[model samples]
Target: MYSSGPKLYHVHNCDTRQILEDYFSGNQEMVFEEDFLKFPIRNCVTTFKLGHIKGDILIDLSISSMIHHLYAACEFFKHIIVLKVNDRCILELKRWVDTRTGAFHWGHVTKLHAEIDEKSYEFQDKEGKVRSAMQHVVKCNLEKENMTEPIDLPPADCIISAWLLDVICKDKDDYIKYLRKFLKLLKPGGHLILVGSLEVTYFKIHKEKFHCFTYDEKFVREVLVGEGFKIDNCNVSRRTVESDLIDHKGVIFIAAHKE
Candidate 1:
């Protein structure tokens, strides 16, 4: 495991899943013959249609988490729009896609991604083969400059506000208002995915400041439920790269449907 003193509020760098596996096993339910994380039903993902129904939009709001979430979405939907709320995460996610370069398996993700498009398997470059119909990934500045809160967004089919809400203060009533703005970006009967750690997250500014709202289960539930999102599945777990030797309870995933 890992050890840290109060001086080092966190015991890790970004790659903490390894050391964490030994320390924060905290109530993680393991119910499969093999590791259950690879199983779709075991992971609590919603099975729904994600392709265009003449008017469906997919928003990956958490710039960083969008990488994997988008990686998953790419198998089914095309013409997706992503919001670049956090440049750090967005850039990193883009880098991951560049590095992995069509490493996703359509056959593997098909059981899950195919609910959106029957041709989900066709989006792959797997088996050393690459398909040419490209998917778009870009940045949307919800708010920039001196503004503390973002502008309202139009509705869509699916929205994933990754790492976007991890900065609001517990007292910012604007937090709820901004969340509604995020929700309104989704059309009725659409889906949204909130991704981040549900616990405390720290960032080093000139000094150190607690992001306070970088990601949380309770905070997301309050905002989404208030904004009329129906909770589908709530998942809290970490991706363990044992080689990294760290664990993080920070990255939580919430998938909900708009009411």
Candidate 2:
């Protein structure tokens, strides 16, 4: 079993609704909007639309616990498997998928995606596509050799890990180890889409603080190459909205293929 540590965000007790409201909602700055929403959606849609990134099954390993980024993938992939750190996240996601009461609204994200694609009339269609494409929401233990346990999942054709390793890993070694573990979940030559917060060491969820592994663009490129991944494309977007809420300098997006 994975043991909890001090200075960690307890996933079990994390308030998904509050998280969505505080960071993801429109009231706050556009940091999350640009880094998480616009950039990922643009790249995913562009690549997939151009017949570059094609896949059957896509695995999401993002800690954000939102399906905003998956909207683009739904257009290309038939099935999507979302791996969460805890049952709470899984349940929260399922609530939205099932359209249950008190489910967090993702219409803003959907609309933004629609605007970017110039398909304003198809935003509802995009939402439905993501909802229907999601096939599983399984719990993940990053510290373990097998991240997804009690469920032998098939190898994925593409993996999307957004701000997950930096938050969960304690050090560089742990990050590398976790990266290797994540690689095992993908088929050979499969695509790996990563979104990381650059030069960040900490972030807060409500009152609790969590640690982030400090890294730069050079480190990310070197690490990915060293771990047998061929860099396909990488881009970094500098943070425009600064706040004491988070210490990130920028957000980095990388698209790679296993070598």
Candidate 3:
């Protein structure tokens, strides 16, 4: 059965600082070391540096303060449109971008990316790049016909959706429908960088348990291929840490291009 709990991205349900310290900083016991430490930071940075994904417009369909992916995207894209699920997430992100007090610090993530890129002291540069590249923070509804409704955004050259579909989708068909909705925001031949929690049926945020759609790597690849995307790179990392925080076996990262 689907969860009737509070939405995961709701301000009260989600703690930006806690999430960064726990999951993104390699401190969460339920998150695998490689999954948090290397899979996202290293792979994304290296892929962007390879110059294979250069573009002018990029759309981010994940949480607002996803600095790990934004750091890489800033280097390649001139304009970034961050499509959020609600005002809470957008407000949190805006605080950071505006350098407001009490804004969640993402120095840990930026430092990690800098270290992996062998530019250990360039965290500030990465932050500036991301801040400069970011153009807008708008609300999006995955279940709606026009995901970014009331705001007709231009087609993007690339879309980065990380660990969002699994949490919001109720089933495999819903996941596929959302994937297609995301594709509609991208230009033909635009790239889709997708990150997912493998076999994760549910996760918790403090006291609330949020539902997630569980699926294997094969299913992910098949759905993307069936939607007219050509898989370019696919990486999976097994879980090494176990805790009551979340239920999952691994994480999957896929970089594909729409055909």
**Per-residue lDDT over 9-54 for candidate 2, one digit per residue giving the tens place of the 0 to 100 score:** 4433566566666667665543477765787778777666766677
TM-score-sorted candidate list, best first: 2, 3, 1
| Per-residue lDDT of candidate 1, residues 1-259 (tens digit) | 2233211212123322221222222224322111222322223224333333223456655423323234445335444665554444445444434556533223433333333334455444431221211233454544443122344444666766654565443434755755666665667788777655445444332233333444456776777787777887777765443311212344566677767
Worst 10 residues of 2 by lDDT: 1-10
- The reply for model 1, stretches above 4 Å from the true place, is 1-55, 86-134, 144-154, 167-174, 203-210, 214-216, 238-251
Give Cα-based local distance difference scores for all models. 0.45, 0.80, 0.78
lDDT of 3 by residue, 126-244 (tens): 78788888858888876679877778989999999988787778778888887888888999888989887899877766656667788999999999899889998998988867866
Name the regions of candidate 2 deviating beyond 4 angstroms.
1-6, 10-13, 28-31
User: Which has the better lDDT: candidate 1, or candidate 3?
Assistant: 3
Please give each candidate's TM-score: 0.53, 0.92, 0.90
Candidate 3 lDDT for residue 254: 91
Ten contiguous residues minimizing lDDT sum, candidate 1? 126-135
